[model samples]
Target chain A: MASPAYIAVDWGTSSFRLWLIGEDDSILGERRSGEGMTSAAQTGFAQVLQSHLDALAAPENLPVIVCGMAGARQGWVEAGYIDTPTSLSAILTGAVSVPGQSRDVRILPGLAQRDRQAPDVMRGEETQLLGAIAADAKGEQVVCMPGTHSKWVRVVNGQVTGFSTFMTGELFDVITKHSILSHAVAGAADVPADSTAFESAIKAAFNKPALATNLLFTARAGQLLHGLTAAGARALISGTLIGAEIAGALSSAGQGAAITLVASGRLQTLYEDAFRTLGLTYTTVDADAAVRRGLSAAAKAIWPNNERKS
Target chain B: MASPAYIAVDWGTSSFRLWLIGEDDSILGERRSGEGMTSAAQTGFAQVLQSHLDALAAPENLPVIVCGMAGARQGWVEAGYIDTPTSLSAILTGAVSVPGQSRDVRILPGLAQRDRQAPDVMRGEETQLLGAIAADAKGEQVVCMPGTHSKWVRVVNGQVTGFSTFMTGELFDVITKHSILSHAVAGAADVPADSTAFESAIKAAFNKPALATNLLFTARAGQLLHGLTAAGARALISGTLIGAEIAGALSSAGQGAAITLVASGRLQTLYEDAFRTLGLTYTTVDADAAVRRGLSAAAKAIWPNNERKS
Candidate 1:
């Protein structure tokens, strides 16, 4: 068997995961680093790369492919984002060369939407979505990846058509931490996340005779008017935001399209139920698994014509 | 004139300002501390207070009157909040007492709105609003204080009848700093604030379709459709958010009221003009001067028997 000869790195704001791939497109070993591009910006990323590789037998003559925030302008090197209706097939055929990397370490450009009413952009996540779509037969599907910045993507014919990110989690954190909503809800961090509160808030956010900003006041107001506790109020705020995102995405991208929630953990269950309650069809995929598969697929694309002989 | 005996403090989230208020209600000496309640959460505010006092000669046996974040939950001491439609009358008539070094000190409570559609709260700044209104006898005015958290307050019959806090500035900071909007504009830390750009954005924000959040995307979208520059696009976002805030506040509390903007600085000036354009009667006040007036009123409230003697 031909030994592993290349690496793929998924570097984001808070963490980094490295995959060592064999010539057969199988993972030989994987490593995780707490030092992501965002935090290790001043410490120099290439230094951390050497250490991460050293921990994994210090393999020689191996090229590295990178994705995510590592390509942000503030990253180790910028992997410029390509506009949407973007595809790996198209990117693979029309790739831009990033200069000055150790042993052919190339950064994958993100996907963006310029023509849309809102100019939406994505980085490493899109490449993974591309890898996911490439693994499937040509069909149109909506992939919802929920995170600090939740994105709803439209993939058609093995190509990423477009996507939009909702500042759901950040806004949640802001409103809860900074707004009076924090006083109403209790134990939000540790709450088992009762859907009753989330469901009701969703209904309020969409049906209210209100402004978007005023919705927040209702969070603080709910405590007084309805005796909503701090945690409950916060849960309502979360529900309202996520619910709004779902409603917005439905109206924008997945109005008639099939949907799959590419998320895991409790949040995955939440998304699944959210979609179900909305009468929207969705299937769940393991997040870590999807990322692994994506990194491997990207590795395969970076090196063509070389097959692993076992 | 009675000798200066007391100190009045209005310490808040980002900056601390104090007035050595003499018995005649004249400012004896003034000082400011970069150390505010927000940053000192983990570092012990008592230490900060001591250090600041150390700089100024520790005064004799006299009381200190303070009104602001020095009394929040995460403040030096949680002086608690007074529910809204709350006026200086209630605060002065029902003031809370506190212990101090060799003398007594009082921390005035911030105003909170529980009966309003949503529960909203404000501290420190309300005192300034009270002071501003106290200086001006113009009855029944809507006061706008714009900053990281902007407040549109209604003062009727010398009492703060109702008010709401808008997270306008913070939202702008977040959207510009962390969201996709960041990419549409330069991420330079010292980027100059373009008033023209800001004004245009405020106009766009108030423009029709009545409202749409994806509406803000026009900033980035215009860049694509018409090749808008980053500066102009950024201005649109700034204007849209502030405009939306004005719209939100207008619909929320500032509606159907005589409006006056009790704030200064280029940013506040921009908002004052926006409010005027929106057909709201708006006025601007110098923040520092108003803050001074607020402390004086608070001092007088605390020591009514010790009235300013000619």
Candidate 2:
């Protein structure tokens, strides 16, 4: 059995994931919980990390590397941000140390684009970019990371040129849960059972991205006038938001740029279908694997001497 | 004072307004409440209307004219709809009468555009349109009525051609209150105090409606990176939604089509500012007066002899 060398934690706003990495650079154990930055802030970050490590029976001296919102101003420690255009490797150098811990603890910094007109910032995803794209990759790449706030990042020859964050997922949640469309989608399946409505909405929004909000209204109007099903209405809302996001993302990208989608589970299937429906060229990367790989890269870079102990 | 001749009411989803008209076409009494369809539906629409009428001491035989959601399927009675491509005066003939009432009580029908691609409907706005545009008006007219669900109707030579509904005001409300942008604009003035942010956001969204969701994120990013004020964030959100709405509304409008803006109060000021910032030519009309005028037109058409009863 390979001995555990270090712990990798992705502490987001509402979720926490920890991986126990062996000396051989393999995952020995993992723990996931709702003890993210928000929860950890109240429960004590040190205590939360200790509880997770204790659950896994990790070694007391196991060095920990953390990413995501744990490094935010309101989180455990302010790791700050590396402003663009920056090399993916620059993130490694910006890690801030949490002093007075029993073991070495470092948190990765976020990335900020200071453009006055299109100001943007991203946390955690920058690490995923490090793992998803090879350090020496050639040409321009458009990377999409879909979640609560879907991010479309542009990379030119391994350096992140810029990126934009679309409030697609969050808007979909609010519109379906709080807006008038809520009634239109009441009792609907979360994933939308109506694929046809989803695809058509994708096309409609992609072609006329300007009519996004109007298209959203059609969910209710369609239900009232055309007797559209609840599932169909939900699908229409999701597809419209996703389609508009893609359109807006690509609008600023160089024509024919290779697309790299970083997502897993339902988001992966949805985006793949959207790209196919829009007739766009793209490839996919497993999000979980990418983030894990990203954490591994950071672990190795920060602790070069922690080689495999057979 | 002239004796009360009839009662005019604009009963909407969340609002109720009533005015007792005199024989001289003046307001004899006025009442306003929050007992719109949603509330009145539970408490009995007839009961709600009676309470207000009783307070005004309206004559037992005084007839009533109603518009807006009161005519909706779920309101007092199912008033149905008048299909589009019809004349504005056609709305007057489609009034549905409430049965078992001592006095004549007629609820005007709404307008419905059954276009499969863009199915749309409007209840109260049609009445506003009836009063906003003259029956014998000529040429193409683009009417912009801003509110919770802002309506943009396209009329050709006094005939209702088609219209679009943008969820601008509602989206702004949800995004600012329910979404992550809520934090960026926490404690900000309800109406944005940052005119610069508002105007800039308006131009940005109007010019690039596709990037709306992305632009929305800037409210947060701007705060984090550029130290944007809470008011600025609020203004940006409002401007983005309104800008996208205006762009979508004008996309189908004929070139140089005259714009008739029917709005009052804060909405009137906001939309007026938007039109001016965009350098678009338009004429403003009071929304309250327009709805009242529409109800008056319906009353005269339904009971010609009621005019100047004194």
Candidate 3:
């Protein structure tokens, strides 16, 4: 068995994921929990990290590299931001170290677009971008990272020119759970069951992005008038949000820019289907692998001599 | 005071409002409560209506005129819908009576646009429309009725052409209360205190309706990066929703159609401000008065001889 080289962590607003990386850049062990920044802020960040390390039986001297909300002002420490248009590899130089930790621990900074008219910021996604796109890749690329806040980033010759974040996933959550649409979507499965409804909705919203709110209302109207199934209502909503998001993202993107979608599982499938339905070309990258590779990049940059002793 | 001629009630999904109308069309007494269709459906619709009637202490022979959710299938009686493009007066003949009631009781039907692609339904707003626009009025008219579900209707000459319903108000409610923006808007007043931010957001969304969801995320990003206040966040959300709605609503309406904004109090002011910010001219109508006038129109059509005794 290879010895653990370092720990890579992605600490988000409501989730925490840690991977113990071997000297050969392989994953030795992984830990995940709901103890993200929000929880750790109350439970003590150091204690949360120690408990996870203890569970994995990680060596006491193993160093850790962290990304995401752990670097926010409200997180473990403030790592600030690197404003665009900046090189993707520049993030590796912006890591801020924890002062009192027994083991050497550092958190990567986020990226911020400071345009007063369209100000935007992202924490964990910058790390994902670091690993998803090659630093020297040619041509313009539009990368979409879908989640609670779906980010659409534009990379021109390997540098992030700018990005836009759409509250698609979170809006869907609030609408289906807390709005009147809750009744329309009640008892529906997590994933959409009606592909036909989803595709139609995607086309409808893509064609008339202005009618998004109106389209969302059709979920209930469709149920009441057309007897649209609960699953169909859910799909309508999911498709509408994703459709509008894609339309908005592509509006500012370069014409026919190569699309790279960084996502996994349900989100990945949904986006891939959306792109296909809209007839837009795209390539998919595993989100988990991207973030891990990003954290590993930072680790290697920070400690070059930690290679596996065969 | 003139003797009561008929009882008028707008029993909506979450609210109940009753007015005792005199022979001369004067409101002699009124009763309001939160016992709308949802509560009444569980607590007994007849009992709820009777309690309000008992509180008014009206004549036993006085017939009741109803509108809104009371006519829903899940309400007291299924009043059904008047499909467009029909005359505004068509709603008058579509009222369904509540069976087994001691006194004559009738509930007004809603309006339905059965387009398979953009199907929409409005229960109470139909009444508001009947009063907001004159039956004999000439030219194209676009009426904006803002509420939980904002209805934007188009009237060509005297006939109701078609309409669209935007889930603006409901989306605002859910986004502010249940989404991550909830924290961004916490401690802020119900209405926005940041007019600058509101106007700017309105213009931004009006110009690029496709970017509505992206603009919504700026509420959070603005706070994180620009130190935006709770008021700014709330205003941004409100402006974005309203701006996008107006853009979408106008997209289908005649270019020079006169806009009639039928709303009362808070919603009225907010929408008026939105219209002004977008430089769209509109005339205002008291929503409360409009609904009452609509009920009176139906009552008169049903019973022509029920005038004041000279």
Q: What DockQ, on C-alphas, does every prediction get?
A: 0.15, 0.88, 0.83
The regions of model 2 sitting more than 4 angstroms off are B308-310
Q: List, residue by residue over B1-310, the lDDT tens digit for candidate 1.
A: 4667567777888787777767666777777877778776767765666566666664655567777777876677677777777656566544466655555667887777776345667777777786667643556777888877777787777777777666667667766765656777865333325566666666655653123344555565566445667777666666766786776666656367777667767666667667765667766677877776776676676766544332
lDDT of 1 at A298: 64
**Can you give the lDDT of residue B186 in candidate 1?**
67
The TM-score values for the models, in the order shown, are 0.70, 0.98, 0.98
In model 1, the number of clashes is: 16
C-alpha RMSD of each candidate structure in angstroms: 6.3, 1.2, 1.5
List model 2 lDDT by residue over B1-310, tens digit each. Answer: 8888899999999999999998888999999999999999999988999999999999998999999998887889988889988999999999999998887899999988888889888889999999999998988999999998999998888899999999998999999989999999999988888999999999999999999999999999999999999999999999999999999888889748889999999898889999999999999999999999999999999989997574
TM-score of chain B of 1: 0.85
Ranking by lDDT: 3, 2, 1
Give Cα-based local distance difference scores for all models: 0.67, 0.93, 0.93
lDDT winner, 2 or 3: 3
Q: What TM-scores result for chain A when each predicted structure is judged separately against the true chain A?
A: 0.86, 0.98, 0.98
Candidate 2: lDDT of A153? 96
lDDT of 2 by residue, A158-221 (tens): 9899999999999999999999899999999889779999999999999989899999999988
lDDT of candidate 3 over A236-266, digit per residue (tens): 9999999999999999997598999999999
Candidate achieving higher lDDT, 1 or 2 = 2
